[model samples]
Target: MSFQGEQHPGVQAPTADSEGFRLNHTMLRIKDPEKALAFYTRVFGMRVLRRLDFEEMQFSLYFLARPEPGERIPEETGERTVWTFSQRGVLELTHNWGTEEQQDFAYHDGNAEPQGFGHICFSVPDLEAAQAWFDANNVTFVKRADQGKMKDVVFVKDADGYWIEVVQADRLGQMGD
Candidate 1:
């Protein structure tokens, strides 16, 4: 199962021991946990699955995920932490203690001259509706769905200037030339 013209010259087949392996989460460093948390939870519709604080290190980790319908989240700290780690597609936000207090502190968004990391994506049920919701919530847009060569895809920026690609899963098939 490969794309029509894509090549993977040096790729090897998966080994048996790696069968159960899956991506758990992607971490992003944020300055203000409050604003980041609000943007993620209110705008993206994600819920905080678990939060771990390290007083000695003066930092905290917040794990968030969009809960499925009828899904139950564990209440106990130990159990919730374990559950959060086990789930796939989780977003982890790391907040350093004093960065929030600094007036001119900012993290590299990886989209400038020395670009490295790219963007994270979220698949929505309805692309148009999602766009409307984003507009109503005052979310910043990098590109609108109709702006680029690619149609039916939107890119928005989060509170920390992270690009989030939004698309409808069913429409992805029609995106190819």
Candidate 2:
């Protein structure tokens, strides 16, 4: 059942025309952009690469990514926007106007019953240090690395209760079924 080399049925190979296609970003709706931005930037070390506002629609989008060491981000807005969209693995947070002011407003985290979308993951160099950092930050943990049957993987919740899975790439290959 290993899918490493074998292609699954009904899957088509990439065509030459799609060679440059890349996943630019994943968008998530947030009730409060300020809180969300703080959590992501402080906890995850992601930088706001670009931001766009739709005044008529009463919503704003914030694009974020973890830049490499010594990476140069374009200073000009036009160039930055283009660079932001061209990069792979970006996170986009969409904030609707007035949701933060609503007392009972909440977005479905997709981890409850009838779940659809799942969590996003981050790979860390040192899993133990990351776990300790999350603990120091008072992060709400769905499961600690040592708690569950599936060891060496941690899940923590964000300000909006969306699940975020944390893992170490080297440890992942050491796991057994």
Candidate 3:
């Protein structure tokens, strides 16, 4: 009961070398490529950095990321491919062919019981504006900006019912100020 300082069981602390590694991307499986692509691009302002289609495997991979304002994805195939891989925090959406045809096909969103993955986050310049946009566009909100216990935070869902954490970048550094 009188534990002053201790290292937890089976726990390892990060070292300076860990800083050299960066998380490249996280993936989500989708049922329909068209539906997924439209939702991400229209609602989130993301672009298809690169897309790989596997006919034999009956699936496709689409790498999506929000490009900087006024930024254009290079026209050259090689340039765009390389540019896509270089960026960090990209979202990779996989679409298995024929999923939309099945009557009861669905991907586990990792939000139900025995949860493993919760959600992906996006930081915006203005939380209120983003929330308003979502509301105006009829985007599904798992947790609204005003309804949540935590103030100034929003959680919205995509076409596939995946939760996306939204925060205000300007207010980020000013949290609790």
Candidate 4:
């Protein structure tokens, strides 16, 4: 059956429920969009699915995805756009012109070490490969456990010094799923 909004030849269009009730993407402000793009792509193997620049608003946004082994992304970009890939979730990068004030600004103030901000996590196919990449890239870590009761988990920081947690995807799934 042919689908209305399915740009791809054989894919099915999103149904009505898919239109209304959908988890599209998550937007987060970063210090620099270009730097953030490099970090996410180089460290986690994500690709830029789409990018938009709002001249009036003086803002730039990037939608990224972790595609499968050999899948290609569709070419689509529009104002207030979204990017999707063959992955479990989405990551949105928003760059607003001027210092708009940090949403978690208070987390860095009056706190001994900004411990509450937690970390951004990416499940790696291999823990060793992930660790090596982090090491080679000189990404600092809040904590590193050789091996504990929990699966191999390492806490690292991103370009803006935001904490990021790295763990094996399969190991985590085995514990929960």
Whole-model Cα lDDT of every candidate shown, in order: 0.92, 0.93, 0.85, 0.67
Ten-residue stretch with the least lDDT total in model 3:
168-177
Instruction: Give me candidate 4's TM-score against the actual structure.
Output: 0.67
Q: Indicate the worst ten consecutive residues by lDDT in candidate 1.
A: 2-11
* Higher-ranked by TM-score: 1 or 3: 1
**Model 4, which residues run further than 4 Å from truth?**
1-20, 76-88, 99-117, 147-151, 173-177
Best-fitting candidate, measured by TM-score?
Answer: 2
Model 3, global lDDT: 0.85
At residue 121, candidate 2 shows an lDDT of: 91
Q: Each candidate's TM vs. the true structure? A: 0.93, 0.94, 0.83, 0.67
Candidate 3 is scored at a TM of: 0.83
Q: List clashing residue pairs in candidate 4.
A: none
Which is the leading candidate under lDDT? Answer: 2
Model 1 earns a TM-score of 0.93
Q: Write the per-residue lDDT of candidate 3 for residues 1-177, one digit (tens) a residue.
A: 775455879867678888667777899999888888988898789888899899999889999998878877888888998888778889999988899788788877789878888999999888888888898878999887778567778999887888899998766565663
Write model 2 residue lDDT over 1-177, tens digit each, in one string: 655355679878778998888989988899999999999999999999989999999999999999999999999999999999999889999999999999999999999988988999999999999999998988899999999799999999998999999999999886874
